[model samples]
Target: MKKKKGDKTMKNLKKKLMYSIAVSTLLLGTTIGVFASWSGQINVQPPGWGGSVVSWSGVTKTSNSSKFAISGIKESNSLDPYAQLVNSNAAAKSSWCAIRQGQTTSVNDNTGVANYIYYTRCKTNNLEPNSNIISYSFNPY
Candidate 1:
């Protein structure tokens, strides 16, 4: 049987449509994978301080990548307080690094006493292959 000219055009159009759909699906999947992220908070306290001095530090996985970021905000009466990010694994203790030093500000409350608040900068670090867990330390130094 002889094929009409329109039949050849229709066949080429269908091929192009299928290719476009397949490419779109693959790209969509990869885009979603790259943008996925997770986040959590850990309560931390400065050494020698009691539970009343504890603060929640924010931590987040940087968009499904092997990296994470941390930030801390604490209310204290100390000078030069800061936050540090460290690998939770004991073997990786040497990997600890100071993330940020607090930007300090003093405010007077109803008691007329000076209250100091520490707002540390957010910092990011790469995840170690065997140390996915992260711990934070708030130091009132």
Candidate 2:
């Protein structure tokens, strides 16, 4: 017996649904870490509210293939980085802190940006407690 037009449409819809599911599953499964450099330190949060970490920036040097990295950050070089983040938001209370290349502590000093213009450079491991400054920045979301 010939299939009805409605039945054919339903069958087509079912096939499309199955294909979509299969493609999604395959894409997710095959994506077992095809992105290498993408595994770097990347974490962006809202400005926050009510003691929810208004805005905290982090910078660290990634060591090894996929493991612990040096937390070297200095305050002397916190000028541009801190200012960079603050400038992005005129009403941002930008606070800055850096961890040592291999240690976890504020190396140089703490920088603050009570008000900003529109320039925030979000780069990590760009400086060290006992080393020169490393410059890095990114686009503000």
Candidate 3:
């Protein structure tokens, strides 16, 4: 028997509802999956690989005689593949630091640092490396 007009309309509405539900389910699943994957990728990062902060510890002081400490995890090591880059940079900038008494230039600067002598981390542009949050403590004398 031929379907009534009302039945046809009801059938169309049901089909539309089914399609809508399917699309919504797919979208919701995708969103959740993406968030889970991205969260993991963003949380813990390795050297040269971008990641979120894991942890931090450090210290600061206005005076050189004061005690201080800085800690952070870098994307890469300054000694990796860039040893020469670090050395060259150190040579270029050793002259600026007046760390030594009566030392005008960095002639005895065997530390192989550019612009600054920093262990565990250094940069040619003097930019602070991104890492996990940190805490610091020290004595001034």
What is each predicted model's overall lDDT from 0 to 1?
Answer: 0.34, 0.34, 0.29
Question: What local lDDT score does residue 94 receive in model 1, on the 0 to 100 scale?
Answer: 18
lDDT measured at residue 78 in model 3 versus the true structure, 0 to 100? 35
Q: Give the C-alpha lDDT of model 2.
A: 0.34
lDDT of 2 at 107: 21
Writing each residue's lDDT as its tens digit, candidate 1 over 1-141 gives 999999999999999999999999999987764443212344443343211122333222222222223333432323323233222221111122333324322211111111222222222232211211223333211
Task: List RMSD in Å for every model shown.
Answer: 15.7, 13.3, 19.3
Residue-by-residue lDDT tens digits, candidate 3, 22-131: 99999998776434321011112223322212211211212233122222222232321111111212233122221111221112223332222222122222232433
Error of 3 at 97 (Å): 30
Per-residue error for 46 in candidate 2, Å, reads: 38
